[model samples]
Target: MADRSFLQWPFFEDRHRELAKTLDAWCADHLSVDHADIDAACRKLVSDLGAAGWLQPTAGEVLDVRTLCLIRETLARHDGLADFSFAMQGLGTGAISLFGTPAQQDEWLPLTRAGKAISAFALTEPQSGSDVANSTMTATLDGDDYVLNGEKTWISNGGIADVYTLFARTGEGPGAKGLSAFVVPASLPGFEVVERLQVIAPHPLATLRFNDVRVPKSALLGAPGQGFKVAMATLDVFRTTVAAAALGFARRALDEALARVNERQVQGAPLFELQMVQGHIADMAMDVDAAALLVYRAAWTKDSGAARVSREAAMAKLYSTDQAQQVIDKAVQLHGGDGVKHGQKVEELYRDIRALRIYEGASDVQRVVIARQTMGAFLGGN
Candidate 1:
């Protein structure tokens, strides 16, 4: 079993511990199924998670970051796709939860929490990745509605979501300040799924196009010019959860490596008896623990009433994800040829962990965020 000792840390409360236990049991019981049909599997997984009431944390008032982190970590330890499904539910609806009007929340949150609806976050465009300020999607005001005309690629749940919390340029200024957020339903007049994206480890991803799709002014999330702030706040909450997911992957890799070394015999002795193998195990253990510390520290900071946690969250994501790649690599190395073989857990993990480093904010982008935040703090006192 993966380590449960992390729950004992002061960073967590009794409710957090209970949530972790419940989710671990739920995932073990419900997540065992063939994932060859990635789309079908994702749909079913989201429905099952919703039916079980696990998606409640993704919506509603009072989002507890600690609970979110614990859920992602527990789910990730069992299934990466399960983790993805759960994370997307929260991420896709985060804007609504944080800034939606009463009617908007009522219209969507219940169905979303019940798994009857899928949600997506439409932010990245064809021309923009991490550069949110450069987004070119336009939402032109026309009386009581805004007509959207642009394409969003690299969108999670792009082809299948029921509604998208979309960001578009609304002319507050030249950069991020000009951006605005809207909740656009998939059934809108001119919205289209341009392409279904395939990656190393598949989940539902796609490119979406909006052609004169009109949404009522009621669909606006927060004030017109507050979209950038809304997006940043949403990211700050979810970024630490990404680190927790990485910690889960690293822990599972360590467990696999440990089991392999004990079972495999070499030179008339077990592989665990070798000094070099022992060193690898030690390094894996340290990396897992260190990653856990940073992940929870960031989560705890957020839960303890920080308006934003860019520096803490960035460090957690950057270190935990980068270290997880290292830990998984070591696990694959320990397995020798079996590691790279198709259908192997370590092999799947190798693919699953890769995108975590790239998404949310890439590791390189996170370093820059950290450096800027650190310097801002140091220089602000003067």
Candidate 2:
């Protein structure tokens, strides 16, 4: 009922259509995962998702953007936890899928795809949130291994990840070029989850500390000096997925509000019949559609062979996330007291949608990215 027709849009191909149909059926059968034990639930979801082959779309011989967006958007609409579980698998190992050596891919990707191994991307540190270049975590060469020392905060799947695609400072050079990406195993002696962060919405997040964690040189992803580029490239691929998740939240919020409005009574009539209420619904609907466009457009552009989708992804993330917050708020307003009531679906979404806007490149950071990209494009006479 929430517009399965998006797949019929020109942005998608036959394979994408097939994926949407299959995932829609899968979501219908699988209910929202219980989060009484969030960690266990996530682990279960990951295994289940992998078994179902949903993780396959995250990478491929031919990466299909429309299919990825369709899967993410559909999953997010059904259950946020499922979306997170699926997304992290793609993100944590994305660098390897895109740029890893054949041996590296064989070692990690199969396990990740099989849900036998959980993954995390360790990039943000206590001192460097959006300022990735300022990360002070050091990975010093010691014989055949790199000795890691520092912390990564705000990491998703932090406590549970079996493998981490970590970035650290390898040289004294300024800016991003001196950084490096490495595949770190959580079982290593010096790596520990220092502190588990309790967020408004429950998920496994933590501050990870690496004190002399030794990683084999074979674990290095890409080249030592190419870490920044690796990070950006990985983000460029996954950021659109973030927007897809936000769009799904908006869609669910709209659906929930519509259902409530049609059933709830006002002055001797249903709320949907009221003119002011109709206006809110109209705005919410428009926002949802606009967000879908931004999300899918970025996905399509990137998959269609754009070198970098920075501008498109920034717009999608900024607009979809920011709009999702507003759309969910409006839904809550319509539901009134029950909206904010404990254990309500919209209530949970209200909290969940907040972080999407803040993480994976915040709305403010996206504006800067868009403006700078636009300026560069115009100045270059493109």
Candidate 3:
């Protein structure tokens, strides 16, 4: 089993501990699924997670970052797809929960939290992945409605999501100041899923084309020129949870490696008895603990009323994801032939952990963010 001792750290409270225990029990009972039809699997997982009330934190007014991290970590330990299902629900509706009007919240949050409707975040474009300031999607205001025309690629829950929190250029100025956030429904005319993306690890992803989709003025989220701030704020909250998920994958790899080594024999002795094997285990253990410490430190900082955790969150994500890749690779090395087998847990983990480093924010992009934040703080003298 994955270790639970980390939950005892002072970073968490009694309620956080209780949340971890409950979600762990629920995931054990319900997380196993056939991922053959990935779209259907994601839909079902979202419904199951919502029905269990585990998704409430995603849409609630005051998000508990620690609770969100605990849930992602636990679900990820059980199934990566389960963790994906939960994360998308939160990300898809994060804008609404954090900055939507009361009317918008009433309409979407309940349905999204209940899993009656799916949600997606459509911020990345073909040209812009980490560079939000370079987005080219256009949302032109015409009378009381905004006419949206552009394509959003690599959108999670693209075709399946009932609604999307979309970002587009709404003004003439250059860079981030010209952007705006909007809530667009999938059913709107001219909005279509043009392609379903296939990846090494299957999930519901697609390219969305917005022809002349018109959304009422009420669909705008926050202010017309503040999309960048809205997006950054939302990322600051969820980025650390990505580290938590990586931590889960690493922990599971360690657990599988431990089990394999204890059972497998080498010349009448258990494989784990070998000094080489012990050394590998030691490295894996140290990396896992270190990643856990950084991940929870970021989570606790956000939960403690810090306005933005840009630096802490970036460091947590960069360190945990990069280290998890190493930990998983070592686990695979320890597994010998079985590690590369298609159905092996370590094999799946190798695939799952790769995308964590590249998505949300890539490891390289995170490094830039960390450097900028550090230099800015040092220059500001506080």
Model 1, residue 317: distance off in Å is: 0.4
The true-versus-predicted C-alpha distance at residue 365 of model 3, in Å, is 0.7
lDDT of 3 by residue, 314-345 (tens): 99999999999999999999889999999999
Candidate 1 — which pairs collide?
Answer: none
lDDT of 2 by residue, 137-175 (tens): 999999998999999999999999999999998994788
Residue pairs with colliding backbones in model 2 are none
Model 2 score (lDDT): 0.90
Task: Give the whole-model CA lDDT for all candidates, comma-separated.
Answer: 0.93, 0.90, 0.93
Reference-based TM-score of each model? 0.99, 0.98, 0.99
Residue 144 lDDT (model 3): 100
